[model samples]
Target: MRCETIREALSARIDGELEPIAPGALDRHMATCAECRSWYRRASSLHRTLAAQPEPPVPDLAADILRHLPPDAPLSSAS
Candidate 1:
């Protein structure tokens, strides 16, 4: 794959949001491409750091979503 394609997919690839790529395509490209490799490394580190973080507790998640519905909802402090 080209470096442009790899650059576009890097974040989703690091997040594991994308379908698996042909295995060696990524390895071969990254081996020769310094910029893409550096970007992937940074993105991978960020993904790891975010994944390692403790998830924030969201009490009554459904209620929170419903309560924030537009039009009829009372203004939230954020507004």
Candidate 2:
């Protein structure tokens, strides 16, 4: 696979959402492409870090509060 194509599909590849052929192509490219292998390592690290974070607890009133907010209003207290 071309480097551009592999780069484009990297995220989906890491997420296990790529088509079988795409991943196989990416893997083949990665085997011989240093740049792509570096990129894959970085992407994999980020994916693992994000996946490791605990899911935030959902507030019972969150939906009700969001429903009443103006469409253009800022959502955070700092805003």
Candidate 3:
């Protein structure tokens, strides 16, 4: 398989998406392709580090946004 195809499959594998490449084929390709192996290592490390962090709180901006709207403005302009 082409390196591009393998790299894409590696991304899907990392993201927990459906596995497209056969497991044996992927392992064999990675074993021989140093560049792909390096890329996968970095990408996997980033994925793990990001996944371990707690989600940041989402700010509630609805009230603040509504306050900025003009009083007479129509909510919807549909005829």
Candidate 4:
């Protein structure tokens, strides 16, 4: 796969969203591509760190905060 294609799918790869074939291809590309490898390393580190953390207790204002957010605002996919 091309570098651009692999980069576009990087988030999915980090999230374990890619199918077996695509992930294998992405892993091979990362092995050979320094830039992509670095990106993968960073993303993998973040995934591990986040995974290690316990979910925070929900605040009483959580629903209020969500209610105040603009409906049209783009939500981040990371959550």
Candidate 5:
């Protein structure tokens, strides 16, 4: 795959969201492309940082948030 395509797929690849071809293409491109490798490192690092920080809502916390919504409001994904 081309650099443009690889760049587009890098984040998805890092997130394990890519189809098989995209991940393989990402790996192959990273091997030979320093720029993409650096991009992948930065993207991976940020993903890890953000992923680690979003503590899942405790049951009580979810309930509390839900309690504050309008009575007719649909329950969010939180509930």
Candidate 6:
């Protein structure tokens, strides 16, 4: 399997999405490919670190956005 294909599969697996390639296939490829093994480890570690962080609070902007909007005009009657 190509390294690109294996890398894509690795990312999908990390994201909990269904992997297109068989798990065994990926394992075999990574076993022989040192670069892929290193990439997978770094990607997995980054994913775990990011996932563990708490999301910052998002301020409600609806009211502020609506306040700057122009008022609606009545539609003219059509013949």
Clashes of each: 0, 0, 0, 0, 0, 0
Task: Report each candidate's C-alpha RMSD, comma-separated, in the order given.
Answer: 7.8, 8.5, 4.0, 9.3, 5.7, 5.8
Write one digit per residue (lDDT tens) for candidate 2, span 1-79.
6677777788777887854455666677878999988998998999999999999987699789899989997887682
Candidate 4 lDDT, 1-79, residue by residue in tens = 7777787788776776854346678778888999988877788898899999999987699678779889986567676
Which TM-score value belongs to model 3?
A: 0.68
- The lDDT of each candidate is 0.76, 0.81, 0.93, 0.79, 0.77, 0.93
Ten contiguous residues with the weakest lDDT in model 5 = 18-27
Q: Roughly what TM-score does model 5 have, to 2 decimal places?
A: 0.57
Weakest 10 consecutive residues, lDDT, candidate 2?
A: 18-27
| Candidate 6 clashes between residue pairs 3 or more apart in a chain or in different chains | none
Clashes of 4: 0
TM-score, one value per model: 0.59, 0.62, 0.68, 0.54, 0.57, 0.74
Error of 3 at 28 (Å): 1.1
lDDT of residue 65 for candidate 3? 88
Best model per TM-score: 6
Ranking according to TM-score, highest score first: 6, 3, 2, 1, 5, 4
Positional deviation of residue 6's Cα in model 2 after best superposition, in angstroms:
0.4
Candidate 1, 1-79: lDDT as tens digits: 7777776667667766763565477777878999998988888888789899999986878877776788676756684
TM-score comparison, 3 vs 6, better candidate: 6
Stretches > 4 Å off in candidate 2:
62-79
Candidate 5 lDDT tens digits, 1-79:
6777787787667777844454565677789999988888898999889988978775658777778889998665585
| lDDT measured at residue 64 in model 1 versus the true structure, 0 to 100 | 73
Give the lDDT of residue 78 in candidate 3: 100
Worst 10 residues of 6 by lDDT: 70-79
